[model samples]
Target: MDLIKTDQYGRQIGYVQGANIDFEVGADEADSINDFEIELKRWNWDGSIRYGTRVFSPDTEYGGIVREISTDTSTNVIRAKGDTWRGMMTKKIIQPLSGQDYATASGELNSIIKSKIEAEYPGLFYGVTADTGVTVNNYQFDRYCTLHAGLVKMLKSVGYRLDIRYQEGDVGMAGYVKVSAVPINDLSSEYELTNDNNMNFITDDNRRGINHLICLGKGDLKDRLVIHLYADQNGTISQTQQYFKGAEEIAAIYDSSGSERDDLIKNGIKELESKKSSMSYNMTMTKLEGNIDLGDIVGGKDYLTGISMKKPIGRKIWTISSGKEKVVYKLEGET
Candidate 1:
């Protein structure tokens, strides 16, 4: 892979191609900031690589600003590490003015995200766009948190993801970062990895999950609001309760501050969904076809374990070393 060096402003400085460099680039669906690291011999250093510089890989579609750089005299190697554009968002906190507890917004998800950036730190993010085409009625973000955390929480609630990329400048113009909100695609049927296809995978089935939640709301003693919610096989919460025998059943309590029955139930449902049984898979493929990416649902089946699942790609790591490349994919909810 080619590692192109650029200034902090996204202006190309130089590039290293077919060099004996080792690097790892990866992203997690649950996180706003992705990370990349580059390690190469001291002889390969162009003397221009320094702190605040940016390195981009068009082949891997991964790049980031260099926040830290270290040189090893014994090994004669140099290492540069930093985070992607999402890291920049983490530096700015969402602070609501006096008498406010949160920074709130409503309407389209894209517009809300853009407005937050423009309001908090204008010109930091350019070409803000959204392709998810999702809209939310209302959302509130806790104060004193990074903008990245706030946006991640808002987007996850609506099943969307954030993507930020650096666009190199044209001629004398300086490059800028592009921010986008995209929908998580369901490509389970289109991409399948099974033992039959000689794919290696490990399946984890966590059975220590709660199926019932007894919610207790505001008030005291018997006057307090109380409700029971059950999670079914499909992870749906409802008032209709179902009981299981022996080890097959699990239950928990959800202490809520809701005074209304509807509000309590809604809170109960959110809590219940989190406690449902988690099933995930981890697999490493040497060669794969088609365009598969993080947040895209994929299919996997392990015949030895009798496990079949369709889950979103939660994280991916790409490593290049010794003239070989390896990519690892972990399903959502996998540790």
Candidate 2:
């Protein structure tokens, strides 16, 4: 793998060669901020690489902005580490204007994101696009948080993921950031890994997961709005269960500022989704047949445990050293 250095604006600076590099890409839900590090001998440095420099891997087509650089005078080695473009969003906080408790938006996901960015930071070079066709009737960011956190929260509720990439500049143009809301791919039917295959994996069966939530909404005591949220057989959150083997109930107090029952239910559902039992699988494979990427669901089975599951690929890490690369895949959720 070759590392290419670029200016903060994405203009090509030069190639970063003869360095040991470790690059990682993460799904929106699991680890949204991808990161990388490079280590090389000080004598081999050309001094072109500095703070704010962007490093990209052509093989992975993933890049990150340099955030820190350090040196070891004793060993004459320099190391640089930074977060990917998605991390840039963390630098900006989403806050409502005067007299408003929440920063709100409606309409298509992409349009809402674009509007927010343009409204908050005019003339910003970032671009937004979406093809997931998801729209929210009412979305609110109540507390001040990083733009990345706000966007991830909004998209996760609608079954989408944030995608960030750097688009190379065209003629007479400087490269810029491109953001998108994309549907999480369900590729379980196409790819399945098992103990019999050329893959090594570990299964985590967390029995302490919450399966039911009793949500309490606005109003006073007996008059307060109430609702029950459950993770059904399919792991889908709903008000009632058609088939129930056992119940693990917990009380969840909804935001007092939210008066609508719909809002309560929505918040409860999101909470239940996260609290469910985790039967997760973490697998490492040297090669895969299909084009499997982050945010895509893949099938896994452990014959010893007789467990078969399909979960989203949450994170991927690539280590390039000694002219060899190794990749690790992490799947989120359980059977």
Best by TM-score: 1
Model 2: runs farther than 4 Å from truth?
7-9, 28-33, 58-61, 117-125, 128-132, 171-173, 205-278, 285-291, 333-335
Can you write out model 2's per-residue Cα lDDT over 1-335, one digit (the tens) per residue? 46778866557877888787877676552344467888888887777778888777643436777889999999998998987655556668988878989888788988877776666545433546644577997688758977877887798788877666556666444565566677776877777788798778887887566667778777777887878776655677777754454444543444444457888877777878888776767777666666666667888888888877787776777777766777767665311
Clashing pairs in 1: none
User: What does candidate 1's lDDT look like per residue over 1-335, in tens digits?
Assistant: 46778766657887854344433323342432356767778787776778878777653446667898888999998888886565557778888768987777777877777777767645545636543567876577877877877887777788776665666667755555666677767777777789777777887787678888899998888899999887777666778765443577688888885458888888788888888776757775555577776566888877677778887776665667766667666665555
Q: How many steric overlaps are in each model, in order?
A: 0, 0
Model 1: number of backbone collisions: 0
Model 1, position 68, has a per-residue lDDT of 85
Please give each candidate's TM-score: 0.76, 0.74
Candidates' C-alpha lDDT = 0.70, 0.71
